[model samples]
Target: MKMQKTNKWILIYGVIAALLIALHYVLQLSVFEVWNEYVPFLEKLSMSLFLIALIFMVSKIIRKLINTRAHLEGDRYNLLRITRLLAIVSSLIVATSFLFQNLYAAVVSFGLISLIIGFALQAPITSFIAWIYLIFRRPYLVGDRIQINGLRGDVVEINYLDTTMLECSGDYLVNDRRSGRIIRFPNSLILKEEVINYSGPDFPFIWNETPIQVAYTSDLEFVEECLLAATNRDFREHYRHFAAHEWEEWEPAVYFRINTYAWMEAVISYPVEPRDTTGRRNRILRYALALLNEAPDKVQFPEGTLR
Candidate 1:
């Protein structure tokens, strides 16, 4: 199978070489004598085609070499190494072109190429710049949960122009969780749109609120104490490291108050690890309920009469 694939590629390469040679001859007959001056535009044209083919061949060879090394040893950083190789190859190509071509010819070729590519890829260039910024700034890493332009998800991959995500909310999934659907978003949006990185440098913990309603006669003070006790006992350890790393302090508190309708409202505000915010909140709720279950009768709803 591999041999057949190799044969097919060889045939394709031969056909491409033949076509480039024909195009070169046709270009040789151009009315513009400048096209035939200096380097013979035909040779230049064929060289350009040959250079493109060489780049692809080199890329394939590098990939194969990486795979072979990975098989021999257990090197798992092949993708990063391959990307570096590509960058180096691109730089070498640019340097060689500038070195060999006459200054005037080089300038004309570069100017025309830049103008055409710039016009064709303005947005893509912007996105690529944004990707570079994200990579260097370390705003968010792969697997981090983030929200951008109102779309929330766990980042799956970061490509040249866009970052891919596994969508994590709305009708897409049960309990408003990650739906397993992949969404690709332009990196330029990171610069243009507001990005909320749940696990960023300073924001590694999510402020989670779990509100509970109780009867008017319920003791607000007792409820507050119980809630605080439950939170400190169950979640303090789980979120302590996150708080220390992100907030540089720890102060977990729960507040209780009586609303206008005389209902006791206990709002528990606690620190939760950014990655597991939802799960931690649910666990806190379970623990709070278990604590309240000790006084089930006292946890009754506020009294009211229907009109």
Candidate 2:
């Protein structure tokens, strides 16, 4: 559906450009030569239209070719953004051409104007430079969950001046799910602040721990076995995507921690994707509690308010 609409719009723009160019010549045929005053305007308009249409058509082709491949979504998004920047630049050059009679004059004039504007708009220009840095440095990419400064979210778009994210665990929510809020921060922030990208290529999973309070008299071995079994079941059932990666590196582990409430904390550390942290922890807890309840002497839960 989207491709069809794009093709239709491209055809429409092409027809408009063809008519504008032909009209530019048709009026100079001596019969309608009285309209020669409009010739220059028509010529510039036609050239701009043709160039924009051509650029968009080529960009569409390139994006379509790349969109078919899997696991290269970030690369495809970067290329799309680059092509759009190219279109803007090429259009500006075309518009500048007719404003001056010669190439040297246009270049010099635009260079001087850009120098003045660059000084006046230092913040925006710095942000644009930061955007360029993001393209190369890639601290985070589209679909990656990242936290910068105090803001935590999933990256959705990286524009020339700002980076947009879908915020997670906002003021009202306690879990890691998105809070239906949009966050737009200046790209320049990347240069000034540290970014925590949950997407790790080397580990392929975010190491997360969920703590459960149990009486110190509880069977330590049984508690560990139950927690590991619960986490392992969840991993085997829902997170099999990590199977091709390092298997031993992501194995679930249980650690005991002393609590001030006179109870022991069983912390189960496991590997999980960022988005699935909450749900995976919930499932593991449910399974672990069910298994532990079958053997009451093995595990004991806190009955008072310290839960």
The C-alpha local distance difference test score for the whole of candidate 2 amounts to 0.83
* TM-score of predicted structure 2: 0.88
Question: What tens digits encode model 1's per-residue C-alpha lDDT throughout 179-215?
Answer: 7788899989988888878866555467777888887
Worst 10-residue stretch by lDDT in candidate 2?
A: 63-72
lDDT of each: 0.68, 0.83
Question: Model 2: clashing residue pairs?
Answer: none
- Candidate 2 structure quality by residue, lDDT tens digits, 1-307: 8667656766776676677667656756777667778766766666666666666666666555555653556666877788778877866766676677555787888899999999999999999999999888888888889999899999999899999999999999999999999999999999999999997555568889999888988999999999999998888899777655668867889999999886989999998899998999999999999998999877888778776
- What candidate 2 gets wrong by more than 4 Å, as runs, is 20-49, 69-71, 244-246, 302-307
lDDT of 1 at 149: 86
Q: Against the true structure, what is every candidate's RMSD?
A: 9.2, 2.7
